[model samples]
Target: MKNALGSVDSVLLLGGRSEIGLAVVERLVRDGARRVVLAARGDAAAIGVRLKDLGAEVLVLDFDAERPETHERVVAAAAEFAGDLDVVVAAFGVLGDQAAYEADPVSAARSMAVNLGGHVSAGLFAARRLREQGHGTLVVLSSVAGVRVRRVNFVYGAAKAGLDGFAQGLGDALHGSGARVMVVRPGFVIGRMTAGMRPAPMATTPEAVADAVAGGLRAGAETVWVPGRLRAVFTVMRALPRAVWRRVPR
Candidate 1:
């Protein structure tokens, strides 16, 4: 449950090893979250230790975003381990090579399955639990790329666009159910995920995004844009003519 100060008590991070997800969990723990469940495919031992050091009861579970069949069971197990998840972060995604996706359409479909389809399953499952318990926040890590798909990474952008819409609709559906969703749209984040990539204008870091998410959670914001100014940037970008937009470099 969330305390009077709007601080959560427990958190479930679907992308346990994600730099942004771990950063958010770390911030929440520092802000008084006592229990955390990290669900991901690979080992979470290091993050578990880090969270433990921050005074959280940490539990690491195996979760595969591509495996929709196991999502319900994973959510159930998380609930069983940590009663009433106050925050559930859906941060798993893949930014595959655009050239590869262009060559292999099947690969693009697989990536979409993880980014958009997996969230559809996990988001609904988490929403049901939050509704049953009557209070919680589901944090959906969307991207500015979704706001206006760029030609360079349209495959990834398309998936994010779909996810952004789904998250917004889900939030609306959960209104007045004592639960809500926070959609975080961040500009290019210079983190483990975007390693070796050229920095985009107004690029941010995982820590910055996490900070924004934590502040948004406290303020009960339905949507948050990291760096804050990206909201206005995207508004203009979204309005640009296709002729001008298509020429914008990656």
Candidate 2:
């Protein structure tokens, strides 16, 4: 539950090892979140220890984004351990090889299953609990790439498009139930997931994204754009002519 000051008492991070996810959890922990549940595929011992150092009672639960059947169980387990979840961050995704996806379409589909499908399942499971408890927030990490698909990473962008829409619709459905959703759209993030890649023009960091999300949640914003200026940048980018848009490099 959130205190009168809006500081949460517990948090559930679905993607325990995600750079941005960890940053958000850390921010929440510092903002007075005491009980933390990290659900990831493998042992997130390092993350658990890091959260513990921050004065959070950290618990790691096994989570596989590709396995939708197990998502409900994972959510239930987290609730059992932490009582009513105050915040659930659905921050699991993959940046697959675009060229490889073109060569192997099946691989693209499989990856999208986890990238998009996993969130669908997990988001719903978390939403249900929040609805039953009648209060909570679900933070969905979307991307600017989804605002409009690019020729370069269309495969990944298309899945994000679906996810972005799903999250918005979920937010509307849960509007009056005392539960809410926050969608974060960040430009090329220069983080562990994007290591060695050339930074984009408006590239931000995990910490920047985390800060934007925290502020957004406090303001009751439905959507957040990291670095803030990217919102205006994307507004122009989304309005460009298709011919010119196609030539804009990522």
Candidate 3:
């Protein structure tokens, strides 16, 4: 049902423990979301307590990005939490070391399963629920690296590329169903996920990405870039020739 936020009352964050996802949840709560369903791999009691303290009715659910078979159930459980699931945030991802990925193809494949295949399954389930309900929004966390793969992190980039493309296609498929999809592309998040990694030229924080996503919801934007400048930067990077782009170090 509708709330003071102007549209939503319930939100489902796939990556409940994700910094960006939690930030987005905070924004939504401030915007009048009355309920929140946090789905993550481990126990979500901590986050649930924090959200409950913030005045949100919280529901904790078990979710594993590496397990596609569980995605449908997760979506169903989210819908059950709030008769009308107004928003779904697909923010689960893993950034493994490039060297380690190179050394172990099996481990690298698992990364792809979680990053790419997981989104595919999760997106489809979320879309079906939203479409059938005839209202809702799906926020997919994409990456700028997906705009164009880089040699240093091509594997991760490739996975995001696949996810980005999938989200775009799903958005189109949901066109006229009263359900919308917003894709968020951030450059580099220097939070817990990338704690030790060097910040990119256009690095951003989880809060910034969450703010952008909140703004996008109000504006009904199909896509958003955290910090905004990354949009312009990627415009140039996407057009660069491979010969010249390959020399640029990460």
For candidate 2, write residues 157-204 as lDDT tens digits. 999999999999999999999899999999999988899899998889
What TM-score does each of the candidates earn? 0.97, 0.97, 0.97
Model 2 segments more than 4 A misplaced: none
- How does each model score on lDDT? 0.92, 0.92, 0.90
Tens-digit lDDT string for candidate 3 (1-250): 5433336689999998888999999988987888899999987778787778889999999999888899999999888877788889999999998899999999999999999999999999999998998888999999998999999999999999999999999999999988989999998898998998889887899988888998998888999998898888889988899998999778
lDDT of 1: 0.92
Q: How does candidate 1 fare on TM-score?
A: 0.97
- Comparing 2 with 3 on TM-score, the higher-scoring candidate is 2
Off by over 4 Å in 1: none
**Which candidate leads the pack in lDDT?**
1
In model 2, what is the error at residue 114, expressed in angstroms?
A: 1.0
Q: Across residues 1-250, which tens digit of lDDT does each residue of candidate 1 receive?
A: 4455367999999989888999999999999999899998977677799889888999999999988899999999999999999999999999898999999999999999999999999999999999898899999999998999998999999999999999999999999988999999999999878889999999998999999999999899999999999998888988999999999987
Cα RMSD of all models vs. native, in order, equals 1.1, 1.1, 1.3
